[model samples]
Each structure stands twice: as structure tokens, then as C-alpha cells.
Target chain A: MTIWQRLRHTLRHGPAPLPAAAPSAETAAALAARLDAAAQRRLGRSLAIRHVGAGGCDGCELELRALNGIVYDLERFGLRFVTSPRHADILLATGPLTRTMAEALARTHAAMGEPKWVVAVGDCAIDGGVFKGSYACLGGITTLPVDLVIRGCPPTPWQVLEGLRALIEANATPAR
Target chain B: MSAAAAIIRAGAASGQRPWPRHALSRERWQAMAAALDAADAPSLQGVWAEAERVHALFLDAGSPLAASVEVDGGSYPALSPHCPAASWFERMIHDLFGHTAEGGRDARGWLDHGAWATAAPLGPRQAALPPRVGAPEPPEFLPVEGEDLNQIGLGPVAGAIAEPAHLRLTAQGETLVRLEVRLGYAHKGTLGLMRGTPPRAAARFAARLSGSATVAHGLAYAHAVEAALGVAPPPRAVALRAVMAELERIRAHLDAAAAILAEAGAAFLETRFGWHREAMHEAAGRAFGHRLMMDAVAPGGLATDLAADGAAAIRAALAALAAELPDLVRRLDRSASLGAGIGRIAPDLALRFGASGPVGRASRRASGHGGDARLVPGYPPYPVLGLDVPTRAEGDVAARLRVRLDELPESARLLRALLEALPDGTIATALPAASGEGLGVAESSRGTVWHWVRIEGGLVAAAFARDPDWLHWPLLEAAMRNGMLADLPLCAASFGLTSSGVDL
Candidate 1:
């Protein structure tokens, strides 16, 4: 096909439909409600997440990446990943805290501004999961004050969204 | 004699299956190590240690061979001096097993950054040293001497939503003079964790060793266990395993292509690839019940059978991908920015590093040493149903992208063929409670994944899973030499090396 024809085809077809297994509208609505309520109180309708991979496998990191893709569209829900911890309001950490990374994780949490929240993603981050007794790891993100924990070998993208919603709701004041 | 034949003939035959493994005396092992510098030396695949011996895996003229040397007085002759690829593994062995590589190059510790409570946690000196009391000292990097070169350290955590690894780059203006990757931040003592556990239990760790290559690693681990027990998974299970592997390769290649496009500032192409990747993952979830297919392949057979509608879901996803792939490829070809000479890997360097999978295929192209594990050390179902391995000569970002693009359809075709000929039988076969040593190799999206397992009485005695990143990371370091700092992301994305896989 010619370039013009291809462009026309793309424009007419639009993007492919999302998969059938994408989270339901009600799930999205519940998350939006929590985000809205949190914004009214203090969050301003956005949560900037700074992800730190402690000592776990890359499973959680993969799921977290999925959240930013078109399917999950995490940014649409006012959540986005940032490079620097100082710019973040929520520190999203994964893995069992390896000894080499324990200090770094602690420092990253400290760099965040006050009223910050820590959400540990994955079973390893919850309590070291499969790596619990390994000598090289501290077995979870316990050195910092953790406000939320999402558990799975590596939690799915939807589970991570729910955890974020729960974090906002728990800290969010009741709608006045 | 060939290095492999020499090593095998010199030592007493060990029980390792599907590949010959022999236990050699220190002298013979040193002789073999010395021979590694020869022009026709076998390629070093991996190196790891047990309490009593240090083992090395080699790929000799498309055949897998293993050799071990008993550690006398907790020290053995090092292979790094003869084989540059063995350097990292040698250092890692020293750190984890407390076995010194006598006269080894770069004696610095690897994977242990003074963070562990004890030195050589897996070694004989596990409790000999006093616990570390203070904050660990900063890691040492090779000093760069140049008037204008300034060093910049990036990540144990970096800009991307990826694994943690520290990259130290010495640069003159925007051009890198040297790039040194200091990893181990993601080390969870995976090998130590697998010790003494049943193969079924330890398979979980293998599956998680690199989440992106879950099926490949899991399949390799299963293959190793099956080999050790002399059990073969049912034909249907074998075909399904191959099916899952192809699905994984397609998804990974799409993700990789998307990452490269995103780094190159081609947002439209990037989004399209991302859409396809997510669609693939969703199909996997629908078919196998997990987006990543984690823990799906177990030691004996599979954890569960494919869903009833699994074939339909997979076919639909592949059809959509196939429909859009041509336009995507055409657009990618027209984008001059991506095709520019950036992050190019030389063919000689690729061969020396034993680069495998798409990375190797891109560099080596049609020439020999396109180290696809499935082809080399041939595996089931894949061999029975013929396959085509893609090749590209450029070895740049564009070449890697082209290789991946070619692979997507190849994988899709293989998936369709496997589905059509999907055999009907039990999905699992029980492994006997037996003892033996086995090595398993699988071609992951990144490259060849090697898992070495020794099962003692149905329990894992000692194990090591070597991800291809272990070899490819050094290639990335070499590729980035003298390249612009801004091109680092594109180079990294093109290589698609995972830190956790190597860090473990």
C-alpha cells in the first residue's frame, strides 16, 4: 500500500481494541473515586511513584511497566513513575530488600518529602517471599515505614492499582 | 583432540546427562584452562562452584560439555586468564563459594559489596569471618586516566522502570570513554535458596530468576530435572512447552522493539509495538492463566494444562499482530534515525563473547556462531517441526530491531504449527525419586539460558541458572565504548540485558 493509503487506513481503523481481560469499568471507577477523594484532601489528583527494585526478581518490575502501557494507562488515573525519589509522593518498592540495596532503599524513602507513602509491591517485598532466608537479603522492605503492601509472586498490574487505591482511601479524609 | 574431547577423556565420567561431565584433577583442569587461549578453544558457557569443586560449562563445536576441578586447600587455577568470558563467573565463584581463583585477573569481589553479614556465605568460611560492623565501602572501578574524562555513576536505581544495576561511565564530553557495570544489587542468593529443596520447590526460584524470561528459565529447569530423573514429559506437554516458549519470545521481542523505538523518539511506532506486546501478554493470561506464564512449567511436567479456549485466544492474538506487522516494518525501514550507525557490535566481538539469541544473530548474521540453544544442543518438538533462525549483518540498533521483527512472525508461525499438531495425552509424567546431575539449556528471548542441577535423592543438591545477560552485558559495555552518552538508552534497549538475571 502507498504511504497515504496506509496513513488513511491507520487513521480510519484507530488503535486495536483492548483485550477482554482488562479491568472492568467499576474497578476503574472505584479507583477514580478514591483518587478524586484524595485529591480533594491533599493529593491534588496525582500520585508520583518512584520505583526502587530492592533485591527481588524482575517480575514486579514487569507488571509495573504494564501499568504504564495503553492497556492499564496508569497515567490516566493520575499515577506516573518518576526517576527521582525527591519528586515522588509514593515510593513504590519491589523485591526482598537485599543487603546491598537496604541502605539505598532507606535513603530513597528519606529523600521523599513529608506526607509520603511507601507501597511495597510483590510477595518478596511483603516479607521476602521466596527469598526469606537467603543470607544476602534482609527479607522485605521493613527498614522504612511501609503504608501499603501488594502481594503476589509479583502482583499483577490490576492488583497494583487496587493497592494504590487502597493507599489513597486509607489516608484520604471522608468526603465532606 | 578437541578441547571438549580432551577434557572429557582426562577426567572420570560424572553422572551428568544429555551432556558429558567429568571430574578432572587440578593439573588437567589447569591444562585445559591454558588451552582456552588457543585459537580453536571451545566457548565458555558458564562457571559455578560447589563445596568441593568448581564446574565449568563449554560449548564445543555445537556440543555441550562440562568439566569440574576439585578445590584443594580452597583454591583452584582460574580460567579468566585464558578465557575473558570466565572472569565474572570466576569472581562470583570466589565471593559465593569462598574458593579462591589462584592467579586470577581482577581479584576484586563480585556480588558481595561488603553488605552481607558474613563473607562467602556459600563457602567453607561461612562462619569464619567476623560479621561486618560498619557501612560497606564504596565499590572500586577501574581508574580512567584522561585529562578531560569525567566519571558519572547511574543507577542501582535508574530512570527506567527496570531492574537495579549501577553503571559507571567515564566520559569526555558526551562520548563515553569507558563503561563499567557494577551489579549484584538485585542478588537474592538464589542459588543458596535452592539448595537442599526438592526440584519441584526449587523450580519456583528458577521461574523467578528472570521474570521476563520466565518460561525459558522454567523450561530449562524442568528439562534439567527431567534429564536427571531420566523422565520425559508427555508429547503434548513437550509441544505445549515449545508453544509457550514461542509466545514468550514474541512478547519479549515486541517489548524490546517497543523499548528501542521509544528511546529513538518514535512514539507512534513505539505505541504500536507496545499494543501488540500487551495483547500477547493478555492472550498468554487467557490461555495459560498468567500474563508472564510464571511457574507454568514445573519439574515433572506442567503445573496446569492449557485452557480450553487457549488455542483460539492465541490464534486471534497472532492474527492481529500479523495483520499490523507489515506496515510497522515498512515504517521502521523508512525511519532513518533508527538505521544510523549507533551502538554497533563487531562480529569478532560477538563471537568472542559467545553472544546468543537475537543479539548474536544480529551480529554474526549468516556466519557461524548464531548460538540459538534450541538449534545447538537440540531440543524436542522444535527439531521435529523445522524452524528458521533469522540473521542480520549490521549488529546495530537497526539490525537488532530487524532481527526481532523477523522473529515475531517466525514465532507466530511456529505457534500455529504447534497448535495444529497439538498432541493429545497427559500433560505430566511423575519423576522417580532418583539422584543424578543434569544440564538444561533453552533459547530465551534474550539468548541461551543454561540451568545446571544436581539432584540428590529427589532433592536439589546444588544448582545454577546462567542467563544470557551474563555474556551480553559485557557486550553492551563494549558496544557503548566511545558512543554518545545519549545513545546509552538505545544501546541498552537494543541489547535488552536484564540486571536481575545476571545479578542472581
Candidate 2:
């Protein structure tokens, strides 16, 4: 596929969808275009991020690692996964937020500085997809007003890209 | 004693205690923990107190005949039990729930340093408070102080591809005397998240707590549910679960081996081992759902059967990994830095703690469920295939790595055998008509991973899963003593600690 075609394709479908999966190809394409835009905008800026989960299958977290893999290279975008809340800008939360992790999540979220966007990735984060309102987890974006939601148990790398794509776009144009 | 006999005997040793290791519900576990307060044995992981019941696991390692005990610490400050291994877990429990052990050693808290003001909790029920403005400042952790030695602080902010741990090293110049640790910077509060999810779906949550050892955690979680519900998995499923476990074991050990090689500074040899592990993971991704093999097992059986071609692919992958291990071993042997400073660390302390996995095996404690016990239920097939294996006596970093490297081929051999004898039967059993509680133990790549489950009206009431990281973290702190600051990451990564897995 040509680069333009690839970008268009990503903007629509997100990433390569699985056999009979629910997400649309165009959505994947759009998500991809967005992810690209997010990274492109932050070419030289240093960003610190922390991943939090209400509760999840953990597939979402693993996919986040791909951001560091040879292909995506989150570091190239100057994105760093920091251990201390002292050095984080964006708090990336996944999972459904089990009762066990509720305090930890709140504790972590509270520790971050202002200008922080809480990105709730995956279906679990969007609305407790697989683990819907289980006693352990309430639901993401609902429990804590989520800034952005990427829908998928584990959103695809490009959707993660696109969601991130949407992230920077939102940052560029503040909500009315 | 045989593993089962040993278990029964171990249970008998603590017969005098009021909690007696067999409580099933959150209330019972909490009551048992409260009862054991003065009886010795105290430290908790994941304090979950809800209408369902309250549950947490207390670790007591001072007496090995009764190595560690899991208790339910409920209302009323319970009596305390603190072995060095329980250090990380206790801090975590205090951070989550208001629960506190009355007089445990090292009562200095972990996560709940008044960092967050919203009731400092893990909850399904809350006051529905609006998002408060004016952020609360995180409390500074109490730094260790002493005149006898200088304190060294290691990473809360560390290098990428590394987990965060703060090690306070006390030493006189270079010769180390003591190492105190401030853990839980990576606390995710996962256990608190499991409150209402059905036992089946919650099993997936456990599997991902750590990136590696996915199979063991899944199996343990599933087994806990199965036990609590009085369910038994299909025989074929049991065999399959065991197969996946050994597959995970082989891969985890391979990863550790590669790290050891890298730590020993043998880039040439390390790269080869690293590639071998990568190749193994690729095969796993093909055979299992994901490379880390997350959520592949459930209470009834496996999430899905490994397809015929997938098994064939895995068998081939195992063969490939086994083929390269011998050469990898020879290269690792040539690495001049194998035992960087083995002299200073106390080999005796690691043994005394009842350390499990390669760490224990290296220290002269006969371990490795497959090689040492002969009763590692799932090895007739898959990575451990028909084989003659052996353990070593060095009990140091090098020895542990060697055990893992040696175990890799054996796991491959077992995987090959499993493929050769693939059975035709249901992959999962019907859920049993069980209620109350039951426990399950699976020897993970690290060591024995335990899961305690509580069920009521066919719903999960409470479940506590413990990883060997809880048992080994303090020992790692102990090992850091006498070793220079440079060896911190190398020593830690060599052990391949799993923070989240141990946290809950």
C-alpha cells in the first residue's frame, strides 16, 4: 500500500482486524492516522506516562509494550514510562479497576500533575467490556471521567496509535 | 516426604493455631489472621474487606517447617507475623485497606503514606464523592537512617526494560552489611479489581499480573476456583493445563537464562540465548494465544484447545530451542563474569528462607518440580518429554541461571512428548457444584504459586493468589548486601522479579 493509502487505511480501520472481529477497517485506519499524528507532533518533546488499570485481561498492557518494540518505538516520540508519579504527564489507565486496585489507581491518578489526560484504553476501560460492572471493577471513564477511550479488550497497536492520534488532536483543539 | 505427604505434615505443624490454614471465606480468612496475631506469622497482600468478606495473605517464614501461612486479617487489629519475605506484601496490604497487623516487624507502611486522600481504599462501594480539586501531595517514604553504615537508594526512577525497586544499602565502603528495601512503586491494585468478576473471568486477571509465568498464575487461579466450587477439570484438560505450564516454565527460564548471560557480560553468548528465547516466545505466540501466554487457562479447563497445527508448531519450536541450549551453555561458561562477587552474599540465608525456583536449587536445596520431585503432574508430554535431568549445588547467581538453562531443554523435551501423545477429549470439565473454599498450588517457574478461593451461591466471594516474588524479594535485598551498587540491576534482573504478580 502507498504511504497515503496506508495512512488513509489506518485512519479508517485502525489496524489489521482479526477474523470476524467487531471493529471496522476504516476505524482501524482512522486510529492509525491519529496515532501517527500524535507521535509526529511530539517528535522532540519529552513525555512521561504511567499505565493504570481498573481491571483487564492484561492484553491491553502487553500491547502497550509494543509501543517500545522495534516497530512503534514510543521512545522515538520521546515518550517514557516512568515509575514515579513525579515524572508523568499522561496517566494511561487500562483494566476494569478491580476493588483490589481501586486505591492504587486513585492513589496513582492523584499523584500526577495537572495538564494530565487520563487515557482509558481497551473495552475494559471504555465501559467494562468483558468484565462489565463486576464487583471488583466499576467501569472506566465512568468511575473517573476519562479523557479518551480506545475500544477493544486490547486496542490494536495502530488504534492505540490512532487513539493517541486523537489524543494530540484534542490537545491541539481544547473542548468547547 | 512426598509432595502430598509433605503438605499434609506441614498443615499438621500449625494445627494448634486457631486459623489452621483451611478457612474458605473472606470472613474466615480475616478471623484466622486475627486469631494468629500472637501465634506468630503475619504479613498481608491485598487486604479486601467487602460485604462478601475480608481476605489477605500473611507471610511468616521464620520457621520453615511451617514456611509461610496465608490468613484472612479482619476487623480488630490482628496479632502480627513478619518474616523477611512478607515485607513487600504487608506494605501493600496496609496501602489498600485500613487493615493493620498490631505489632509485625517493620511496620513502616508502603503504598498508603497518605499519598491519596479519597478514603485511601480499594472499593466497589464508595461515597460517590465528586472528583476533588486541589490535588493531595504524595507522602514522602520514610528513608532509612543509621550511623553504622551508609545508605544507598536505588530506583523508583530506573532504566527502561526494568521494574522499579528502591534498595537502601547499608555498607562500610565496599563491603556490604545490610540492605533495606522500599517496594510497591508499581502497585496496580489488581486484587481490589477482582471483587465482582466471576471466578472464570477473574482468572485472566491473575494470569497477566506478571508478564512471564502466565500459565502458572492462570492454573493456580483456575485451580482455586475449581477447589472452592468443588469442581474438577477434565483429565485431558488437566494434562493440557500442565503442558501449557511447562511450556511457560521453559520460556520463563529461557528468558532468565538470557538475562544471566547478559549480566555476566557475555554479549556474544547472551544474544544467542536471547534469540533462543525470542524464538521460543514466537512459537508460544503461535501455539498459545499470546507470547506471554496470558489467560490461556480457565477454571474448567483451558480457554481453548491448542489446535493440531499449533501443537505441531510448538513441538517444532521446542526442538529448535533445545537444539541451541547446549551451545548457549558452553558460551555462558566462557563468560568471565559468571560469578561477579559470589563470595560476599550469604548463600546460607537464601537457603534458610525456603527459597523456591532456580534460586533455591542453586543453593543446594533439591527443587524444580520436574527434576527433583518426579511428580510434576504434567510433564509426560510437551517441553519436559521423557527425560533424565539433573540439578546443581552452587546456589549462587551462576548456578540458578545454569539450572534454568538446563531446564529449558527438558521443558522442550516435555513439550515434544505432549505433542506425540495428544489426547482426544473435552478440553474443559463442567463446573463442579462447589461452595465454601479450597486451595490449589502449582510450581511456577519462580516457585510454588498458591491460590485460595472462596465461593458462595455459585459466585466468587474472595480469592487470594500469592507469587514466589513475595518469598524471594527480601532474599534479593539480602543478596544485594556486600555487592556493589553496579551489581544492583544485574543481580535483580538475574532473579527476574515480578512486581505485579507478587503485589496482589
Candidate 3:
């Protein structure tokens, strides 16, 4: 294709956006159970998340980065991965909890304001996937309450976005 | 004596070219270092220590044979001062196994941050240490003395999307005086986890060692086990392994290019490249079960054979990537501003640091060794198909980016060749129960990935998978010296080094 044609094509017909992944029924019900009308009013549409790599291979991190790519376009869903945990409403973490990074992860979670939710974004974060009982890692953090777990070797971008949407939608409902 | 001749004289065996082992006293080992340094193409493959012996492996640039030197006892003379490439390996051996390199420079911990449940988790006496308690103090950074220098600590946690690494940059004004990288925040004790497990079952640990280089690690581990067991995979299995490996290379390079473009402030190019990468992942997902091709290249062969439809889908994806790649390259090359912020690494620095893959290749130095196992004697298919190794003399971020871009076509060509020549045979061979040691090497996206496995009573007694990052990360430090502090991230992105790969 010619440069002009390529430019025109990009300008006129942008790349296709990723289709939303439908979350499981169980996930939807769990979100509904946790959130209520009062919670919905308190938490608005937007969720600022701070992501932590406690101790992970870059698989989940790459998938997490992909969530913000042109294809996934997570910004369109009012879910932005913020730089600071203090401004975040959700702490999205990947990797098993390694002792070296444990304090950092705790500090990050502690920095987030109250009413914050934590979403474990891969099998490593849910429970140590391959590095389960190794001397170096403690699997995922159990000290803090976890709100949701997205499971995959490195969960796809859609799974991450879909999980975030569920968390945000839970904020849209009233807590019991 | 020539390194090859030394190996031959030491009784190197035929089949996978077993490393000729020569046990030497500390004095002799130190003396051999001088001889290796005086050689035209001196190189250090890796330095590792077991319970009773510390070993060093060396390979010359053009030689087919590898020499292993064993130094009995807890300490061995350091090779880093003379060879330079053994710096991190010695540090790692000290931390992991408590084997001190008597004269080694840089005694600081490479992968230990002192927060382990027990010190020297891989050492023989690790079980005797009382369990660790309470959060340990943060790692101490080695000080760079200067009147006006101030340090900028960038991460263990920085931006939300960033990996876990601590970069201590001592700078005078905006110019970097020295950059010391403290990694190991992502350590999972993968090597320790492989102990006592059969090689086939333990293959999962290798696959997960570095998520991005899963196929390369898998192939390396598989090859190690195969070599140890004296089993050769079927021809079709080899072709399938090549197919998966090439697909991985395609995705990895695309990801690296996209990251470099993003760091260069070319968001358009980043997004376009990212789109292409995702499309490739989608294609890979259809062909293999996972987008990253994780565990697809299993021991003996693949986890499963590719169906005719899977082959067609993979072919279609490669065709699309091949068609669009040239235009992408043209646009990237046309951008004069893109190369402006790249921190320059000298060829000698790359050589001294034992840089591999694109990072080493960009330097265009004799030290930039293209140690692809496929090209190694007795390694099949690659020699038969013919492969091109690309290199450049710039040793800057742009050169590294160019190398990555240049490699895309080669990966595509390999993919096509492998697909066309897909042989008819079973996809896997049953592994033999054995007790022996073997070495595996494969050309990963970044560079040569090496795995050494020792099987005892049908189980892996000891295993080590060395990522290319072990060689590349030090080069990052040298590249950052005398560079603007702001350009460090761009330079890092171009190198595409991973903490998990090295931390393990």
C-alpha cells in the first residue's frame, strides 16, 4: 500500500478494538453480594488502580500492560492504572509474594485510601502458580483481604479488564 | 593449546559433545584463566558451583568444544578480573551456594537481598539455619564517591506498569556518573524447585523461568534431558519445536520494538507494533494452546502435534507480519529523533560484560558471540536450512532496535522453512531412565539461553537455566554511564532485559 493510502486508512478506519470478555456468572454474583446502593453512590464510575509486581515473571505484567494498549483500550472503561497507590481505589497485583517484595507490596496496599479493593491478576497472584512452595516466595498476600482473582498462566488482557469492570460495577451497587 | 584440542585431549565424547571436564587445583585454575585471556577469542560460558566443587566453563568464539575446569573446596580463584564475563556468575554462586570467588571483584549480592527465609537457600547447610523472621532492611547500594554526585533511586516500585527493580543512578547534574542495578526482587527459587523432580515433570519449572523465553527454556531443558538420556527426538518433533521457537521470537521482537518506540515517544508506532504483536499472539493461541506458547515445546517433542488447521493459521499470521514489517522498518528508520536519546555502549564494554543477543550484536564486537545451539556442530535443521546472524557496530539503542527489527525477517524465514519441511514422524519419544549430566542451548529472542541438567536416579539432582539477561544486564549499567539520566529507561527498554530471568 502507498503511504497516502496507509495514512488515509489509519485515519478513516482505525484498528479494531477488543471485544469485552463476559465474566463468569459466579463472579457477577460475588460482586453483587459485596456491593450495594450506598457503596454505588460513594464510589463513582472511575477506578484508579495501582499495580504491584510482588515477584513475577513478566507474563502477567505484559498482559497487564496490554490492557492499556490500543486493542484493549482500558481507558475507555474508566479504569486507569495510576502511578501512586494513595490515589488508587484498587490495587491490582501480579506475581507470587516474594519476601524481598513483600514489604513493598504491603506499603503499596497500606498507601491506598480506605474502601480500596485488591484484585489478584494471575495464578501467581492468586496462589503461587509454578513457584508455589519455593524458599524465595510466599505465594500471594493473604494478610490483606482480596476482592477478586483472575486466573490464567498470565491472564489475558480481556480477563484483567473484565475483572476490573466487575469491581467497578460492584461499586455501582449498594452494600448489604 | 587450542580450546578445542584441550577438550578433545580431555576426552570429550561424541554425541551431544559432552563438556570435557578437567579437575584442577585452585592454582592451575587461576593459571588457565591467564591462558584463556591471552587467546584471540576468550569467552566465559558460565561459572557454577556444586556442594563440593566450584566449576568454570569456557568457550572460544569459533571453537566447537567447551572446556570445564573444576576447583575443589569452597573457594576458587576469580576469572572476572581477567575474563570480565564471570562477574555476575561468581556473585550469584556466592549468594546461592556460599562458594566464594577468592579474588572476584564486586562482592555485592547479585540475586540475594538478605530477605530469604534461610540464607543460601540452595546451599547444603541451608536447612540448619533458623527460619527468617521480621522484614529485613532494604538492600544497601554500593556508594560511588563524588563531590557533586547525587543518587536517584528509580524502582523496586516506581510506575504502576513497571517491573520490580532498583536502579541507583549517581549523577552530576544530568549526566550519569555510575548506574548500579540491584535486581532479584522477582526471585522465585526456580532452580531449587527443580531438585528431586524428574526432568520431564520439572520441565514446567524451566517453562516458567522467564515467561517471555518459555519456548527457548523449554527446548533447552528438553534438550538437556534428551542429551542426558541419550535419546534423539523424531524429525517431526524437531521441526515442531523450531516452529514454536520461531513464533516466540516473532512475538518477542515485536514486543521489544513496540516498547522501544513507546519509550522514544512514538506512540503511533508503539500502538501499531503492539497491535501486530497481539495479532501474532492470537494466531499463536490458535496454533498452540497458549498465546506465549508456554509448555508447547515439551521434552522429547511437543505436548501435542499441530493439526493441519493450526499450521495454516500460523502460516497466515507469519505472512501478514512479513508483509507489514518492511513498512514498519521504513518508518522507524526514517525517524531521526528516535535515535537521539539512546545511551551508547562501547563494543569493548559489551565484550567485557559478555553481552549476548541483540545487545551484544549491536556492538559489532568480536565479543558479540552468536552462540546459537542450532549452529553448534551436531545440532540439526538450522545448519541444513541455513541461518543468518545479523550484527551492527553502533552499540546504541538504535542499533539494538535495528538488530531486533533485522531478526524479524530471519525468524519469519525460519518459520517458513520449518513449516515447508515439516517431516512425517511421531511428535514425541519416550525418555529413557538415566543418571548423567547434559547441556542444552537454544537461541532465545534475546540471545543464547543455556540449561545444564544433571539427572540422578531418573530425577533432576541439579539444574540451572541461564537467561541471556545474565550477560545483558551488566551492559545496561555501562550504557548508562556518562548518559543523561532521562535516557536510562529508553536504553533499558531497547535492551529488553528482564529481572525475573536474572533473579531466578
Global lDDT scores for all candidate models: 0.86, 0.57, 0.78
By DockQ, the best candidate is 3
Worst 10-residue lDDT window for candidate 1 chain B reads B1-10
Question: Tens digit of lDDT per residue, candidate 2, span B293-399?
Answer: 66778888888777656787777766766565565566566664686455223444554454666765566533432223223322222333444555656656766
Off by over 4 Å in 3: A10-15, A21-26, A36-41, A174-176, B1-17, B39-41, B64-73, B133-137, B366-373, B376-378
Indicate the TM-score of model 1: 0.94
Name the candidate, 1 or 2, with the larger lDDT value.
1
> For model 1, how does the per-residue alpha-carbon lDDT over B1-504 read when each residue is reduced to its tens digit?
576458656788888987878888888898888888776688888999999889998888888878999899989999888888988998899889889999888788779999998888888778777888988778989977869889999988887587889999999999998999988998899999899998998998999899999999999999998988898999889999998999999999999998889888998888878888988988999999998999999987899789999999999999988888898888887875684688899888788788898889999735455768887788998777888888888889888888899988889999999999889989989888889988998999999999999999988999999999999999999999999999999889999888888878
lDDT (10s digit) by residue, model 3, range A1-176: 43566679878987467677655556766776765522533467798889888888888888877788888888888889888888988888889888788888888888888878888888988888888898888877665678788999988887777788877666665555
Model 3, B1-504: lDDT tens per residue?
654335333443423325535555555666666565554545566777666666555555534343444444666778777777788888898889887887887788878887886777888767776877776656777867769889888778886687798888899999988998888899899889999998888998899888888888899889888888888889998988888888888888989999989988998778878987888788788887788888888778888678658888888888877777777778777885676547787777676565677887888866545445567533566888888878888888888898888988898888888888789978899887778778878888888787888888999998887888887877888778898888877888999988887888
**Interface DockQ of each model:** 0.60, 0.08, 0.72
**Which of the two, 2 or 3, has more TM-score?**
3
Better lDDT candidate (2, 3)? 3
Ranking by lDDT: 1, 3, 2
Give lDDT for model 3: 0.78
